[model samples]
Target: MNGVAVGVFVFFFLLVTIMGFAAARWRRAKALDNLDEWGLGGRGFGTFIAWFLIGGDLYTAYTFIAVPATLYAGSAVGFFAVPYTIVVYPIIFLFLPRLWSVSHRHGYVTPADFVEGRYDSRPLALAVALTGLLATMPYIALQLVGIEVVLQVMGLQAGEDASWFVQHLPLFVAFAVLAAYTYSSGLRAPALIAFVKDILIYVVIIVAVLYLPSKLGGWDSIFTTANDSFNAFNKENADAIAAGDAAPKAMIPPAAAHWAYASLALGSALALFMYPHSVTGVLSTRSRQVIRRNAALLPAYSFLLGLLALLGFVAIAAGIKVENAQQSVPQLFEQEFPPWFAGVAFAAIAIGALVPAAIMSIAAANLWTRNIYRAFINRDATPQQEARQSKLMSLLVKFGALAFVLGLPKQFAINLQLLGGVWILQTLPAIVVGLYTRWFHRWALFAGWAVGMTYGTWTAYGVPLPGDPDSHFGGPLELFPGAETTKVYIGFTAFLLNLLVTVVLSVVLRALKVPEGVDRTRPDDYTADLGDEGVEAEIDPHEPAHA
Candidate 1:
């Protein structure tokens, strides 16, 4: 059972648990009974804290596991994560500062809050809120999947013959602890713990990338071994590949899959900031300057991600073999590292899940409290009431994620996350484009979102796994409609169709003089800084959201 490794893992886990609870006291405020304090840590974090928080939030446990796993599985486009992360920084540097400005000026806690204030359409705002909630569920589940993979490699999971509850008892205990501290300390828990999380991750990745390659006969040997393995598999499976019963593995994507690779990278970049957790981290910053500065600095993690992705080849070189590719990295650590350091690696992964899961649950809860509960259920809800609702809903959100991991097949998690990218990207026309112009009719944006969501989901559902035609959502790429040979990311294709529909409908709606909802913001709102008029160091929860 690797007692020394398990002990080290437990020690770090306990340390974070203590920090998570103590975070409520770390940032003492007047009270956490308001969204600003509870959901956003008083919106006073500077560039340093935001850098770690946003880094810990965006680069999740799933990235640690799945990106390497993709390479381990020999998916041609597995390394798309590196390019997408590179692409996202420039995009956020351009627009997220504007979102930060408007959100602070309006006391908007969630993106839906911004949408409703901008468009004055409750239904459209509700759609954005619900989409964030739906997309985030499977995402949180992927974090749990990360934790589960670590536990399995550590010999912490119960035997397969054990009852399901017994089998997942450790996972449930971790979830309960995460839910408790997040509920008690709110955003402060993750914001505080992010410092520790990022440090451990950096240490682990740096050591693994540097030391493991040397131990495994260097990078050249690693790549050669991985390529040879792929070639061997392809040669053995030649008949099956020709009969469309198996995929041909490759070190680099073939010419035929070039569009698929590019589309995945671009599509993921466009979708990254649209996630609620990403917005929550941005909105919690002290100023637009902090957002901009962090946008510039966060690319350091992308460099780390590229190194981490190469570890998949390292695992191959080390002769690490597991039926599940997701387990390869964890298994590699167990086999190669000392028992104690292996524990640290496992703890790094498990703790990595905690930070983002906390942020995601909080982000989802904020959406429910602002757009669903207050907007639809209680028009006169107070700030305290909103905070209370969000706290309760955050618990429910985590539980929903727990249910997802328990009830669903874990193999499809990567696919579901891609599907989430497709679903959340549908909101870009409303949120990102709305930052620049209000030319889009609210109803038209809403219609476009609907079409994109429907098409993306249906198309993803129709894609069968390469060797299993009966399976669904087996991958993110599909044959481009009307181009029999070209395959592209479904999200990118869906987003283009959404833009087309939104633009056409806006033109028609304008010609018909459709009622364009009132925009409560001014041009200056998008450019406002911390010291600007009506922009405060900390948000006033009592102020009317649209005032």
Candidate 2:
């Protein structure tokens, strides 16, 4: 084991653990017995705090591992993440502030809560809540995967002959710590810890990108080496490439992949904010202006992400090699940096996992307590009861994610995460479109959601790994139906079909005189600010929801 690196990693882990539990007192609320405080940090974070919190929530540990890993593995299209993040901010600027306003005005806690309030349909709201829960599980598992990758690189794993429990003891301990602190501190845990997480990430990435390139000749040398490596791989695998048993490596995508890159970027951009955790971060802000300001400010992370993606090429240039591409960057850090600083990088990745995992668990738990439990099981539940249920459910959610990592194959989590993007994107018509207009019949939106979920999942299931026809969900891109040569993100294709079905069905349902549920929000509610008539300084869970 790398003793210095492991020691440094442990010290930082303990520091964050202390911070996580202590966060409940950082922004001390009058009571922790309400959904508003426990689930959303009292919904009063201003621009600065929201920026770090949302940034920490969205740019996760798996992203740190996976983005660079893709490039290291010679998939040029993997850099779509940089552009995906860029495209998302403008979209967030346009719609999310409106969502923030309405949610604040109506005391909505989850996106599903807003859908139910907007359509007055419990079943549709349940669908949204369940989808959020399902999509979030694999995502939380991916965070564990991130932590696991770092631990492996740190030499924390037991020998190959060790029992499964012995091998994964370190991971289990990390999972326990995450669950305990998140249960105690709720949204505040992640919000407060986000400050440290974002700072460490920036410091590490900036140092890595700036310092490493200079050490390895320069940017020009790095690019040339990476290109040479790809060409060598292609030349060696010429037969496999021709037979479609292996993919050709490229530093830049060829013309045939242009649509693939664009579609992944566009699909991912649309799906990012739809995640329950993203909604949770947005709703935690103080006012609509906070959301808008963060939208403008968050793009800076996109810049960081672009630089971070280059580290994949850097790994190639540095002559780093590993069986798992996810370990390439971590291995690079270990080899290049002194043990002490390498530990800091590992800590950054592990802590990065903690922030998002905490937020996602809390977000998923809120969906359960509000949409499923309060809406169905106990309609008359009190605010304290709701808080208690969410806190307990948060523990269950975290452990459930832990089970996913421990019991299932690692590849399963990664594949489900890909499907998670598509699954979560299916909620867009109901959530994003509902933010603009209520013209969609509630039933039509429900049908569209079902159809989209079904189609996206089925199509993704059929995509084989490059060489293995039997493998499923090998990647997110698929040949666009009716277009032989062009491939697109399955989520985008499914989303279009969803919109088409919703529109056509709405016309038919309207002519059949099917009921459209009453919208509980006023037109003005979507534009209201903190001091406006119905918008409260602190939302009162006891108060009746807006009529």
TM-score of each: 0.98, 0.97
Quick one: how many clashes does candidate 2 have? 0
Q: Kindly list the per-residue Cα lDDT of model 2 for residues 233-321, writing each as its tens digit.
A: 99999999988899889988888889999999999999999999999999998888888899999999999999999999999999998
Q: Write the per-residue lDDT of candidate 1 for residues 1-547, one digit (tens) a residue.
A: 8999999999999999999999987656757888888899888888999999999999999899999999998988899999999999999999999998999888899999999999999999999999999999999999999999999999998998999899999999999999999999999999999998899999999999989988988889999999999999999999998887888888899988899999999999999999999999999898888988998899999999999999899999999989999999999999999999999999999999999999999999999999999998999999999999999999999998888888888867668987999999999999999999999999899999999999999999999888898999988889977886678999999999999999999999999999997899999999999899978865443533221
Q: Give the TM-score of candidate 1.
A: 0.98
- Residue 381 in model 2: lDDT: 95
